[model samples]
Target: MSADIPATYTAARPAATAEVSRQAWLVWLTSERRAARLTVETYGRDLAGFLGFLTRHLGAEPTLADLARLTPADFRGWLAEAAADNLSNATRAKKLSAVKSFLRYVERDHGIAVAAIGLVATPRARKPLPRALTVIDARAIATEIGEVSDVAALQARDTALFTLLYGCGLRISEALSLDRGQAPLPGSDAPLRVMGKGGKTRIVPVLPLAREMMARWVALHWQPAGDAPLFLGARGKRLDAAIAQKSLRTFRRQNGLPEHATPHALRHSFATHLLAQGADLRAIQDLLGHASLSTTQRYTEVDTAQLMAVWRRSHPRA
Candidate 1:
């Protein structure tokens, strides 16, 4: 009877395995009440990896019960072992993230209660200070881009893009993604509409220099369509972030700016300059699309450091 057992079992097994994965994905998607689609997808991939690991190491599929039995200590042991294997902090963090997310999904979807996974404590990553050029360095880089007279159109475009970034504190992605009709510049009473992180929309005031540079670029191109990209590539396509970074690099090299100069440095410079000018921290947070004033407050620290440096140089005391 065992020898006569059907090939149908083998065929049905594959289908059953696929169905289980599909159901796991769906459960992950639908289980969390407030989870974003992207979050669900990320956790789904993580859970899948966890399940795969269980299959390999334990020689049995892990159920919600198996996950519930996991403690923070167990998770930490896994992380420590991974680190001992010379895995980078980033990779180990990603793996732990997958484990933690799976445990949460098991609790939510399978009604299996586990202790809070946050107790596992992810590895602390060093928070690098934001790199922002000094106002003089910013002006020098902008001037270098503007002075590339061999390509008038490209020069105007780069000048306007960097001006919008540094002058108005716009993200490089936001500036590149601007639509043609979104302009005529925000009036003193009205702020410009900007789409920021997580598809949230916010209004930011347009500075005079940003308005003037944009207006000049628009006049030069004369594209009347409302839906056209505010900044375009050679073929009139939306400007790519990589291309903008490359252009900034060329300008940086020509102008002798520091090695850390990047498009984002302009944004950092914007916030730092605003703080130097006594702009409110909350107001700067709104302009820079920072979700928290704490994030914006880093620029205040930058401003404070600069003030201290100046005081040390100018003070009569040694």
Candidate 2:
């Protein structure tokens, strides 16, 4: 029953040459890859942790030449240390990905190829199934979420935003990124052209109710014109994601909704509901703008689990 001891490792400081490469990679991540600030910082920490492990394992400061000489065993030792820390497989996997990304950058950009790093197997991280709202709950969020807001415009905004999310299966980022000109009109049959992840665009049909609500909100929007944001903040600027999430959190808290009731959950509900209604998995993938069909297949697991739950509740054999 003794607690696991911490690894007695210190990160080896990089030589000036290696340090220059690391800094340059970080800069490239920011400017060229357009990585988020948090991602850059997290990858920086992961790399630092790997270097720390190398310091202890190799008993010396790591140079660019040392990086080029790293073996699969060396990478495994670092992963072992992370495992010793009780980090989940997902976290370990992300750490490995960060190290691999750094090594790839070093090889490509600085001509320091660590070919042995490629021999190391990546950690298998089990992604949790997406949590979706029931059909009643999803519809309630779209129609009644506005009750939490007193201001007429805010109420209308909440209704329209949730409606669009549930109807169109958009990620919050995708929905928030919409320009005023892209807003679906009340009576139009035009499919929405959404710029999804990786700068890929997909067309999603808007629900008539969603369009009607969107048109209502647009009518009340201040300066709703060419190239302006589709959804405006209280200060007439583009609405922040945090603000939208907070609005939903407030609504859920007030309405006795489950903690899983989030804007993204509405998207999940959209997919799940469509699946229940016999929508094709590939078609759902296109609607959600998922690059992979496997990603869309997770909803099938969710649907199966729900059916099992219903069976448990209603079947006579139990």
Candidate 3:
């Protein structure tokens, strides 16, 4: 079993064949599938729960053959139990998805088809719309976030990071992944190349203000090297996403910014503001590096919601 799959999750031990296949499936997920560590762990726990249920339902530890013999009713019973436990629809859907993925893997890799499991329907969950900060708030965050840091370089780094996030609509992970050599400078017209989710690469234009802040931070970089991380922690290692998030949290509390004013909100603000200004939806999709235009379309919903709020306040109609 992968070390990432904790040995102590709420699970009954599977029979030998099931245990071996489960271990192999997890290895495939982490290695060949390139699934994120957290994703793997969550799926692992979901599968563990399913196995525990099977152990009780069958009156013995489940085996590969037992998984193939599972009926849709068995799956429904598990869903019913989860619903009784007060798991949200979204949580139940995710658990169901994990179970299906594992079953698919078993069929493909081990030639042990659990065709009955495929008959289960996934619970529908409403995806929450992206919450964007007002333009005034986004601009204020990019400018004032640095105040949370006393060290001049740290201040510049935080300011630069937030500026880039808003200006280029880069995810925090994508921004933190950049190297010193990829840093943009003032007057450089070349667009910044970002490696986004699923290892997809896309180039985004960097505004002059973002470039200016980045240049300032680069100037104060400690022992800078071409291959070194563009963003650094106090210990000179690559900055952790958690640390950057905490800095924003601290700044928000100090400045009374909305609780939703997060690093990601800056990215959401970028796309929403652009959409409101009549930028092409397709172009915004490319800039955001979204594989599907539907994903980028969420910004339109945010934009429409903002417009409705403005109209409601101004129309003065009873």
Question: Each candidate: how many clashes?
Answer: 0, 1, 0
- lDDT at position 184, candidate 3: 94
Estimated TM-score for each candidate? 0.59, 0.64, 0.63
Q: Name the candidate that leads on lDDT.
A: 3
Residue 60 C-alpha lDDT in model 2: 78
By lDDT, is 1 or 3 better? 3
**Predicted candidate 2 versus true structure: per-residue lDDT over 28-77, tens digit per residue:** 99999999999999999888888878878878767888998888898888
Over 4 Å off in model 3, which ranges? 1-123, 222-224
Q: Compared with the true structure, what per-residue lDDT tens digits does model 1 show for residues 76-106? A: 6667767787877777777777666555554
Error of 2 at 50 (Å): 24
- The C-alpha stretches of model 1 lying farther than 4 A from their native spots are 1-123, 185-190, 307-318
Worst 10 residues of 2 by lDDT: 5-14
Candidate 2: stretches off by over 4 Å: 1-123, 222-224
lDDT of 3 by residue, 43-108 (tens): 888988988888888998888878888899999999999999999889999999988988888777
How close to the true structure is residue 110 of candidate 2, measured as C-alpha lDDT? 58
Shift of residue 174 alpha carbon in model 2, Å: 0.8
